[model samples]
Target chain A: MKTRIFSLAGIAVLLALCIAAPQMLDAYSLGVALQLLSWIALTQSWVTFSGLTGYVSLGHAVFYGLGAYVMALLWQSAPLWEILLGSGFAGALLALVIGYPALRVSGPYFVILTLGLSEFFKYIVIAVEAGLESSGRLIFGAPDPETLYYIMLLLAVVATLLTWGLARSRWGAGLRAIREDETAAETLGVPVTFLKIAAFVISAFIPGVVGAVWVLRTTYFEPMQLFSPTTSFTIVTMAIIGGSDRAPGPIFGAAFIVLLSELLWARAPHVYLVILGVLLVSFVLFVPKGISGQLAWLMRRRRA
Target chain B: MNLKSIALRAATASAAMLLAATAFAVEPVKVGVGIAQTGMFAPAAIPALNAYKMWADDLNASGGLDVAGTKRPVKLIVYDDQSDFTKDAAIYEKLITDDKVDLLLSPYATPAHFAIVGVLERYKFPMMGSTAASVQLKAVKPGNIWFPTSALPDVMGPELVKLMKAQNIKTVAISTLQSPFAQEVEKYLKMALKDSGIKLLSSVEYAPDIRDMTSIVSKMKSEQPDATFSLSFPGDSVLFMKAAREQGLSAPFQFVLVGPSAAFFSKIFGKNLDGIVTMGHWSPYQTKWPKAMPFFEEYSKRYNETPDYLDVALAYMSCEITQAAVAKVGLDHDKLRKEISSATFDTIDGPVKFDGVSNASTPTMFLQNQEGKPQIIWPASDATSTFQKKGPWAN
Candidate 1:
């Protein structure tokens, strides 16, 4: 009970800090904070589905790209809230449509299928844009950085709450059971397919919105870039580095990567990715449970 | 000592002190640029980056960036965009808010350029964009950013059709890469071809990451069109050139959209690259632009190789225009912006005046690879050499 109260207070403090960041930080720091919030939202959403279920999705970019596409298409046509809503809806709808068949596969096959599907969708978008003869679209006069930052913070908070709530629920246990042994979980009447699809759909919603906001942030969209495979790769890398098994893991992951990128990119752009690769490899090998997991372990050891 | 000698000594001492004081008073202008220094875009960006470096070096050698008569040395704060738009935007934000650079130069490609338009708009900081051309540039707000390239797809498309018509080309086959710039060019070229009464034999579009052009080349060979247009970027340009050479796909009026003007293309293709028409306006062989050859020679001497005729020329021209504009109005944002918008600054490509975002004075022109040199071959006025039919593949 004491630990639970402490955790809740810690979360509240973190939320307050996030809320104050735009006002307190310099423009560059605020931009970096915005990036941090974006990654936190993305990684948290990924954790909701991929983390709890141990699905290890590598096609997370599809949702992000599709969301951006919807936002790009309806940019000036719709209100900000409506465009964001439409983007989220587009991502959810895509998840629902693809999730059924995709959830049937497991392990490496599922991973490859997700990766391939995103690539297929990327090309399709490319083809559609080419056919329309509107190669890429640019958004003008997007919401100020402060507005985007606040929205992103809301998303990150919501995603964190969703993951934290879900992880502590009965459904969360059932999802973990499926991860441990899918056949056993299905036989035990866990409603495996339904839960998987639901989680997948839930996970896609925020990333879609993140993508919409990101397109606004960049003020330009090219299908190739929006649907880049590296985005998906980075998401998975962050998840693994931060600990994919729990809600708090992604928060640590996002912070670590965003902060490292900030510190390294300006000073040593060429060697930044190389160092990230090394760290990612080290985390996977040594601290497999990630920073959160390591922290939890240390706390438990001290208590014992 | 005599009174005349003493008086002269005093005058010389004060003059030297005044000169030193004047030099000390002017701070170095912190010019910033975020470019693709690494990743896939790096190969294309190197020439532009080199041009920026060379321009700064040249300016420093000639005293400094002449900021309204008080010559301030340029201190370029360059960041590697890593070929990501978000990173590119962040770099720009850092450059503006943190680095507090006085002037801004453009990032490399069309997408990166478009990415930073919002930042430029928000800061109300004006930038001279090079190595970017799209019809969409017109849609951008006219004050903060200006593109100096004459290679707009809308303009180049009709110009290419006109050039082809001059050669009495009746039929054309087009293979375009599925990139924004390439696709836009293809769309315009098709519209122009339709209007020109030119026959469209076949048109194919390939993905950007395509590894082989064997099938695309084979299909083009079967059509046997009078003209073949490979609307490709540098990578695919090399692929198309190699495949066309190997498959012996010959067309008299062969035009490769981008690559042939790049130095690497001539290096890779050698004598075979001759007579291949490509998109570029400024050429060293054009004696009309006095600064062109000296720039070409100096860049070649410095880099130990020929520069990319298209990108390097555009990059240097942007720097020259920026230098000229800064020289007139110093670093005051409003003054500099007004000066850039209204002024007709001399560039290596000749006099450049902006009517909105596009270059008003420089006509969209094409270059043909003639005997190892990229020579202006179109629009008659800018043509250094008469149009030549592409010869058979050397293979």
Candidate 2:
């Protein structure tokens, strides 16, 4: 009861801070914040499925790319809210279609399948754009930066809260059980396949919404920019580095990586990737459980 | 009226002197360049960046840019975009919002330039593009973005065909990387070739990152065209040339787009480069334009190497355009944009007049390699040397 109250209070303060961020910060700082929020939303959505289910997906960028495309295509015809919702539904539908076939295979096969799926979608989008004789879609008149910032912040907060709630639900336990031992969980009538699909679909929906909002803010993008396999790897790496086992792990991880990227981008742009690689390797070797997991362990030790 | 009055007078005089000094000081005009300094685009972008820096330094040395009646020193703030469109957009935004640069210069490559046009439009910042020359950019119709380089692919294509017709080239083979920019080039070339005396024997498109051009080169060789044009990036241009030589395939006329821009090409091919025609915007040897000699001399003296005149000319022209506009409008962005849209300036490339959408229809010069040096060969008046009828490797 006390822990719940503390969590609620913390969330309230975070919400207030996000609400006031645009007014408080300069445009440069606001842009940085938007980037951080984007990473956070992507990492959290990735962890929602991969964290509890113990299934690492390397193709989540497909859903994000699809969402961006959907938004781009519909922005001129449909209302903004409809475009946002349509992107989310499109992502969920794609997740359901691909996840059923993809999840049949486990381990490295699943990872490869996801990675290949993103590449497949990337080429398809390229072909479609080429056939249409269009370079790419451009949003001529976009909303103000502060409005987009608020939308992205709202998405990030909702994704974080949804992940927190899902982690404590009965469905979450079933997913975790399947992660531990799929055969044993199936023998206990856990409906392992159904649970995995559900997690995957829900995980995909958030990134779709975020991607649409991202396109609205950016006002322009091409297939390669949105659907690159490197983006998938980045999402996975952020989640793992933050400690994928906990809800808050990805949040911490995304913040650390995004801030570091911004700082290194300004100073030593060429070596930013090299520095990130070294840090990732170091985190893997020393803190395998991630920062949050390590902190949790420390608290337990003190209690003992 | 005692010692106190004298002390008060001294204080007032000192404060007045400080105010006078503050009033006379000039604030610098800041120019921002967000370009790809690393990754695949760096080979082209770094040279452009260096050219901009050199131009800024030279202007400052001359006591700065002429703004109205006063001279304000020019300062350049540069950032590396890493050749990614998303990152380029964010960095450009920072340049506008954080750095508050007075003038903007376009990034390197078509895709990066296209991505930032919306931002430039949003901020009402006028940008002069040096490297980007895509016909596709005309589709967006953003009034503030200007292209100061040679004519875009659409115009350059007909010019190329005119040259081919003049040389009595009956058959042509073309190969390009399968990118949007390359596609636009192909589209325009094919359009220009329609109904012309010359026939396109083969048009091959290869992936952007394909290392092996043997198959594509072999396909072109099999066609046995009188002339071959390879539209490609610098690295791929080198690879294709090397492959062509190894395959023992030679055409009487070979036109390349990117290879001649780099000195590395001359070093690699040496005398073998003779008779190969390529497109360029400017050359150090050309003395037609008044600014050409001074620019080439100063750049070579400063960098201690022969500069790529195309890159130097583009960078120098952008600065010259900005300086001219600012001088007319005195730092008012709207009035400055209007001034830029309506004015014609004499640059290193000669008279530049922007059209309705701020695209200058500058002429593209065709040059042929002669004894390891590029000499203008086409458009008789601009020709420093006549076109060679046959290459040394011609069968």
Candidate 3:
């Protein structure tokens, strides 16, 4: 029944998009909307790793950027769909490789190590060959927007589905346990290290794919674009703000943050960051469970 | 016979996929704008966007840009690069490959532009850039894909030396923000200062975002150089000026670069901006071109703001040259840019021509910032307002 409802809702959105895009959206607005959707996908995927397991990563852009660069390099040699799948697989492989060493560290040290690892990977792996082809899109690039938009829309749906599946799984519960009391979860034979690494791998996959698609959508990529801290930070913040554990949390947080930042941007740039800092502090101190948690609380009160 | 049919069938299948996805049938001439809308480049991007919008509107109004055979309307497809180098690099690739824009609008900001230009160089597209003075664009060698907007800071060393000698001004103090871009200026200008009898009073550098710069200005004052050449940006530039004024540390003659000048500087600082000078792109007082005024009127009316040195000189001139180039050599890509490089356009700056190596138009005028206004004064041939030295340059 839940799957039916999910499928129905997904179809409804896609139907609405197809119906509305030609009529309502100009090429420019579609471009912006597609970009916003890509970021949402990225942020939601971040929740699967850092939000659920309490493994805060400040350097997810390394994955996102690498995914983009890898796909871009592949794009020169292959087709768009191949690049998308390749980027996702590459991200997963990278996460699994790094996750072993990264999962060794516990508590705050793990977070710091993940951050440092991303930075190290960026300088060593990606930028080394970036100079080999410097000018222009590096290869036959500027993708048609209509195609990129459809690709991005499909990616967003796929990412959301992945998150939905994770939310319902036994692994999801295990991750929550790891977040709450890691020692207790481990004693229960939750395979805490393995689960954490899996979460990181799974979380990184969507962003990697999304990043590649995002480059296709925008038709541009460079080192700074892919590996920016802003990409990681924004995604992580959205997950935390919405409600880290639930499926709805990241979506709410992503939309809320993007909308808020856009409005703040029009007024004065950088003030939105201060507002984000305040929101984070307030949420941590007063509303520990996050925005979705608050919504759930209100619903329970109403039922009573 | 079977193998030939199979190869033909594969070609047809590929063509079918291309048609189904996005028709690559090039009917209208497409142009691409690869400006960074989100990242550190946003400030520079905003003005460039405005300039493009103005140009796009003008092109459309005049029945769009002319192609050789068909007068296809110009469409500028803009993409937000979101300040990711990888993303931007990807964007340019897609633009040239898929969208298949005939001309790609040059991006803003040095680092981003320099990176995106690689795609241009890779594809060998004629990219007219508005990035800051970077020797990397053309370097000592010339590439057809390369064109930069401003006079490279290397040019500043020789130009400033000439200005100082011409004015009999010597003993200069210099300061630049601790940015790679600003550092480039300092590196080149310091070398040029070597050839001149100008004694180095004191040269200082500051953090890109200095909270309080009074000490720096105070230190400059203590050195007591004949003139000060300070390089600053929008935020720090204004702060430095206000701080220097508050501290009563006034250099009689100061040349401020990459800071505030022209309308933006005037709108903000007004009379307090007096006695400042900057390397400028164009001077209204210097140009008598008929095409120049219409550009000013259209520019001022649309944006409701006056044009600046680079705005009038580089932005407008580049647009004119681009239009004239394509018009001269029908979108042949090969012949178009050489025509652009060789073709002389009477710009707001004067009879402008590109020196392929530096991508700069020689006989470029150095602007004087007098009483909070930018007026072209250098290159005496084009001088309208004789430079009146009031504070530091005053004897």
lDDT (10s digit) by residue, model 1, range A1-304 = 9999998899789889888888899888999999988998899999999999999898889999998999899998989999998898889899999999999999999999999999999999999999899979999989999999998988988998899999999989989998999999999999999999999999999989999999999999999999998888888888889998888888899899999988898899889999999999999899999999999999999999
Per-residue lDDT tens digits for candidate 2, residues A1-304, read 7867997899789889989999998777888899889888888898889888888899889989899999988886887888988999999999999999999988888888889887887888776775665556666676667888988898898888778888899988898898899999999999999999999999999889888888776677677778777778888878868888777888888998888888898799879999999989988999988877988899779979
Off by over 4 Å in 2: A302-304, B1-24, B141-143, B271-273, B378-381, B389-395
Q: Which ten residues in a row have the lowest lDDT in candidate 3 chain B?
A: B139-148
Candidate ordering by lDDT (highest first): 1, 2, 3
Q: Determine the iRMS, in angstroms, of model 2.
A: 2.0
- Give lDDT for model 3: 0.68
Poorest 10 consecutive residues by lDDT, candidate 2 chain B? B386-395
Candidate chain B TM-scores, in order: 0.97, 0.89, 0.84
The DockQ values of the predictions, listed in order, are: 0.84, 0.41, 0.07
Higher-scoring candidate on lDDT, 1 or 3: 1
The numbered model that scores best in TM-score is: 1
CA RMSD per model (angstroms):
1.4, 4.7, 13.2
lDDT of 1 by residue, B237-351 (tens): 9999999999988889888998898877888999999989989889998888899999999999999889898898989999998888888888899998899999998888999
How do all models score by TM-score?
Answer: 0.98, 0.90, 0.62
Cα shift from native, residue B196, model 3 (Å): 3.8
Q: Per-model C-alpha lDDT, please?
A: 0.91, 0.80, 0.68
For residue A61, model 1's alpha carbon misses the true position, in angstroms, by 0.2
